[model samples]
Target: MSRPTFKRILLKLSGEVLMGQGQYGIDPETCDRVASEVKAIVDSGVELCMVVGGGNIFRGLAGAAQGFDRASADYMGMLATVMNALAMQNALEKAGVDTRVQSAIPMASVCEPYIRRRAQRHMEKGRVVLFAAGTGLPFFTTDTTAALRAAEMGCDALFKGTSVDGVYDADPKKVPTARRYDELSYDRVLADNLKVMDASAVALCRDSDIPIVVFSIRDEGNLAAVVGGEGTATIVRKPQA
Candidate 1:
């Protein structure tokens, strides 16, 4: 099945998922599974870009809120993301998918610096590009980085690969009666203050006219399923019939 929804997509993954059953750090099994899902998506012929979050290693915002220097903590967070990105790149390549790691902070010895043209070119050439470094600034979340990269790369939609299947009226874990939405408008998300992502990221995506598809990355084969129009996630976009 082919999704009538999107063509090229930017997949945003939280590094915590790569930690598997552990509290932190990359678990090889989890990375392999993630890589397998990614392989399936590439096999479907959909051009893809990736953005990774560093929560598994460190959360700069959380530290800053707890009295840590915002800039220094954020820099550590960026470095954490780079580590996660490199791990993911290694996994993907092991799974036989050509992948590139691009960092917003210049690190030519390790990965290429974030370059719009280069990323686009990589996707055009059937390579998956992993964007790291969280906008190369402190006080910005990876969610915003995803939206920014999606808009800049001309992605058809942004796919947030989370643990939950989709956005809910309340935290599904806490509220058994929480209602799951199959589809929603960006305006509705904003008005209701839904928690799919940070407000800045949602606002940026809305302004850029980018639809966001939220789904569980841990689900086996879900990535390919979503790209094939069989996802059981929520689609947030401009109003449509």
Candidate 2:
């Protein structure tokens, strides 16, 4: 058996992943499946942190476009993330994994609020901490939050689990022939305008010198594979000398 490549990881999940068969709601099946995968990973001795997107339930920017206040809309998006985080927390605990939901926005009535020192303690105690609310501010996507958390947590890798398995030269959905990159330079990802993540998020990871592992989480066990350095991902890091 091969050794796991990381001691710790920060997983960024899209809110749409929780929707399952529903158009805009939490799907118990999807949550349970994800929880199962996470439990499997935890059993392998990896510390984990998570950041979930709120696009499935709501996107503040979408509301802003509909003539609503942009900041208010973003706050709403943040709240949606809290809901997803709580749902995920429930699933993980049911799977027998210790999990914590730390919200950027204070909601003491439910989960704990984001506190750097306390979050570190949670990880050291072998609990998976989920970060929600997008930096607790407007105009920043959860991608940046993932990148920021990975750097702060000093994780070995930042895994962006998306619908696609890897970053493509073009949108594979639109261009079937779009070329995929097994390895990519941080500079190139930004210059080409690849949809892997937002410029701010990619830039943060780049500056922090953390590699972003892009992979598909739909298939069971892929997360474990990527974390184990099985080479089933697009690894984005600094260019070689």
Model 1 scores worst on lDDT over the 10 consecutive residues at 1-10
* Model 2: per-residue Cα lDDT over 17-65, one tens digit each: 8997689989988999999999888898899999999988889889999
Tens digits of per-residue lDDT for model 1, 166-227: 89999999999999998888889988999888888998999998989999988888878776
All predictions: root-mean-square deviation over Cα?
A: 1.6, 2.0
Show where candidate 2 strays beyond 4 Å: 1-4
CA lDDT of each candidate?
A: 0.90, 0.89
Residue pairs with colliding backbones in model 2 are none
**TM-score result, candidate 2:** 0.96
> What is the overall TM-score of model 1 with all chains considered together?
0.96
| Strongest candidate by lDDT | 1
